[model samples]
Target: MKFSRFAILYVSFSLAVALLALGLQHFLETVPVLSPHFWLLFAVIFLLTGLAYGLSDIGIRKGGQVSILSLMGGLFLKLLISLVVIAVLIIKFPENKLLTAINFFSLYFLFTLFEVICLLRNLRDQNQT
Candidate 1:
């Protein structure tokens, strides 16, 4: 997929997720289901996913094994950065460690799924050509 197309789709998806998160947090205001730093987590995950997608797309355009390597590398870097963020959050906010971790992973998986689907579509298009 083109970078422009990916950016549009990704921004849309991020906005939808943000809206859903806002609704969920509002509905569960009394409960501590969501972390206090929800927006920070959202921004971090969003930027990481976009960066990874861009890296993978560039790799795909270059062809051959570079594509797979770049995809894997991007994912690995995302994971590492996410882990560091989680660790810092847990240390700084010990009261809501579990909630923060859960929310972080939830967003991580959701974005990863979207990234995979888009990449697969791109690969298919490349193969067809």
Candidate 2:
């Protein structure tokens, strides 16, 4: 479960989820299209989460206080970016505010889950070695 492998997995999984959502949106109107900017939100979530996890993995591999600092910094950076993106969307698309918020939060939760799982795997590997 190296960081590189996990990153790739995250990207692939994100894409699959996006496709599934798109397909579902066709059948169920409530599925949330993320309209006006269809795939942008998905891309952002994947990229940001992958970047954060990859950087955290690098820091953890180095070992020491750096690991804790990088982990916290990565989490903070991710949260900041998500908030900023959501806020910008809110301002830009006032009419679709609810749909936009729901889409962003859903992606955030999914990516966060991916991040935590990868980090936990890193931690277990570190403990074993």
Candidate 3:
């Protein structure tokens, strides 16, 4: 879980997701399943996840209870920011609220799961050392 390693892995994951989303959008061109602002959502989630990971990684290096607190704090901040972004998007563009929310949440969950998995692996490694 070095920051560099995490950055590489996260960027790769984000790119993969972006490609999948683009493909899906292309496939469903006639339908409006995904919002036009899908790329915006992707960028927001990607930056948030990276920022959270960096903060948590720094805390992990410091050790002790700080690590746990940092991880929790990062998760909370990410969730809060994501909610705000989604709410604004929904309110501002009320045309495809449901579809946009669904797409946004799916990306959010996927990114969150990836971060959690990486963080857990980092914690396990820290314990082993």
Positional deviation of 42 in candidate 3, in angstroms?
A: 0.6
C-alpha TM-score for every candidate: 0.96, 0.89, 0.96
Candidate 2 per-residue C-alpha lDDT over 17-88 given as tens digits, one digit per residue, 9 for 90 to 100: 888877878878765566654468877877788789877888899889999988988888998998898888
Could you tell me how far off, in angstroms, the CA of residue 124 lies in candidate 2 after the best superposition? 0.3
Q: Candidate 2, which ten residues in sequence have the lowest lDDT sum? A: 30-39
lDDT of 2 at 110: 85
Error of 3 at 77 (Å): 0.3
Off by over 4 Å in 1: none
Off by over 4 Å in 3: none
How many residue pairs of model 3 clash at the backbone? Answer: 0
* Per-residue accuracy of model 3 over 1-129 as CA lDDT, tens digit each: 787888889989998998898888789989876787888998999999988988888888899999989999999999999999999999999988988999999999999999999999899999999
Please provide, for model 1 over 28-79, each residue's C-alpha lDDT reduced to its tens digit, 9 standing for 90 to 100.
9888767887789889989999999999999999999999999899899988
| Error at 46, model 3, angstroms | 0.5
Q: After superposition, how far is residue 66 of candidate 1 from its true place, in Å?
A: 0.7
State candidate 1's TM-score. Answer: 0.96
